[model samples]
Target: MPLSAASRPGGAGLDFARVLMEVPHGRLSGTLLVTGDPGGRFHLENGVILEVTSPGSPGVETLLLRSGRVTETDWASAVRSGAAGWRVGAELVARELVGSAELQLICAMAALDGALAMGMGRIDRVALDPEPPATCFAAPEGIEPEWLSRESERRIRALGGQPVSPFRDRLSRTDAGTRLLDDGIAGERRDILQRANGRRSSRDIAFLLGRGLYAVTVEASRLLHEGLVDVAPPALGAADGPAPAPEYGRNPEPTGQPGRTEEASRLPRRRPGTSGITGVLPLRPVSGPWRPPTALTAEDRRFGSAQ
Candidate 1:
């Protein structure tokens, strides 16, 4: 069947962790589609994760190209062959481009990386498709969603120790005298820092760097906690422009008496059934104020009450 974006039944809440657990426990087989920042799909068979794909991370093909293991032409040829019924990984192995074990490792790593990225941000929406696209290749073994959830939890805890959640915040270089490169930063970390323009969010940096969002987010969080970077102020909305200067020398319309009495400043009279505490308390009818009893009744004394 063609891919269709279906909403959750009964308008259920979106919780990545809970979904992961439930899918595996129920031994369900389907593609769990998640939509949001770093949105992705988890392909599972009987609760075992067969594959994962996310916009927030590089795929196996990109990884191979970036690692210089294969040329673009070679990748294209392999893909064409795979689409023609030969498994891409098998084709590459047959062509002596990579070993069987190596291909398996790469596929597993890519799946895990994508899953990690998917777990990093809020899952805004989700759907399950009983039928997923048929592929020429199959994973040597499936990954347990339970394990993925545990690893995700560990990653979250590690990130929680930092000052910021990079996936959710934009970061920019700090003016601190300490330099990132001077501290032996090189390769990916250096590349990430160079792209930290205070305007791009971590997801943007990931796409720019052609790396996994989770990896970039974790590194950005570390850089922030180490004071090598700072969180950028939130961008203002179109309606958030500066307020017009007050009309000087013109008498402003009286919102109230010239000098509103202190009594007027007291909390707005609670709606008949609302509490005096504006938001801290629930909106319920206020009973009479508390008062001490003049004397405890015999019944109260029996219950060990004090007068």
Candidate 2:
């Protein structure tokens, strides 16, 4: 493992950072459509982050309904009563289902978490959308773009690639993992362990359970380190590569079957004394802000194309 985009000046993370900062510096308003797995969009209002949407993270509706804070019937009713096109938050507040301040906080958290989820994956290309849709919930006094970029990076890099991505890594239970569940664990990790049944990614678990993607991924990483859970390989077509065997979660009972399921752990693991957890590597100290060379070329603008 070497320094990644998070640490490398020329990485896509830095490119996005530049874009985020530059757009806000000019006090621009638009949505940045970032392309990648479970790609996301950042809606900016005069350079302030109004909302962010991503498939890798739970949205406001998931946080409301899936968490049991709001019932399906009530939510549907509110949606029907929504005004200003998509302002469901206002309806919820007016109906006394949720508080105005609380709704605002939830909107802010969802947007920031969505940005975090986007940071955990590759960003291929970013295009600006001038007419971004108004969300059902909007964060009051929206987040500043510079702080958004900095904080998002701080959160993502703090994990240091120890966590598997909800977008890329699908989890399954190991024999040990099954035992952990069978022994009757409790709380969020327990729920996460129960759902790591060889099919759901962390995103799926978050949506199903109304948990934040970051929280679920962190717990999954802990389970992975404990040998209680493992990453299932990608589902490739027949022509993709050498036919990889299908990975399945095992029951607590051990069968006389000769092949062990541990071999099915497809994701890479770190070797001792190496930064092999993922792309995370120690960043060299920076003396100043990074700038393109004076002789900027078309190639200089290419963000992580070689990666």
Candidate 3:
């Protein structure tokens, strides 16, 4: 549906297209609208009204993966084969799976370009205006649940070229916390606390820290408790981002022991059998070679790897 400028508020431009979705029973194509985004959420009133977002540096693009378009297998394959993550988002475009123009749309959506409403389907009998997207879309009348879940996730990925629900929250510091603190937070912990500079979530940090998630959590919590770190609220979309290096030597003091290795005590102590476990201990002690704390202040990092 090509809506005139007058039909929309503030003369916002509108563009509509019909894309065929490859589904099991048969090909399913829905009418998608591309209206100027006042809010940057490349939102489309498609099957169930969806919002698409990206991480890291927000790009300019609109890669719509509708619920009725692809399959679960397609999404997993793209991810497992190292295809659909943010690093690969641009690659997918480069490979021509998505168009340059589409990329612009996706970017606009991510940035919340405008306050607008986009309709889906050949007709506009049912429309949503600035409505919160439906999390789990109901089948079109008679569609099966099995098919619904698969198609829903697929459509979700297709629209955003990303996963439906976020794998983790934005402010979380799972693994990266371990690494950045590995050499033992070189200076006062308070300096390394902001999330605005693009700190990675625990998942992203895990890859960098070369440590398990549990270990990272312990380290992050220790930093938080000792007033060295602060958990930033979740970003609007993806979690990982670069953070500005903090100043050091303002209060250089390694007050904690061996960098406060509290991995064993991070978990909450719970009663046995309460949560279905028969006989579970709250925590198990660890015995290993003690590694000295590694420095991690802005000055330490700038003064070469040796701090």
What are the runs in model 2 whose C-alpha is more than 4 Å off?
1-15, 82-84, 233-307
Question: lDDT of model 3 at residue 133?
Answer: 34
Worst 10 residues of 1 by lDDT: 269-278
Best by lDDT: 2
Top candidate on TM-score is 2
Overall lDDT per candidate, in order of appearance: 0.53, 0.60, 0.27
Question: Against the true structure, what is each candidate's TM-score?
Answer: 0.60, 0.68, 0.20
Pairs in steric clash, model 1: none
- Residue 112 CA error for candidate 2 (Å)? 2.4
lDDT of 3 at 62: 13
lDDT string, candidate 1, 1-307, tens digits: 2223324421222244456666656877877787654567787787667667765555666556656777778877887873435366667777888876666555655665666555444345667788853433345455656655554444444444455544445567886513756687778768778777665555556555545555676667667767777887654431111111112122222345422211111111111111111112111231212211323123222222211
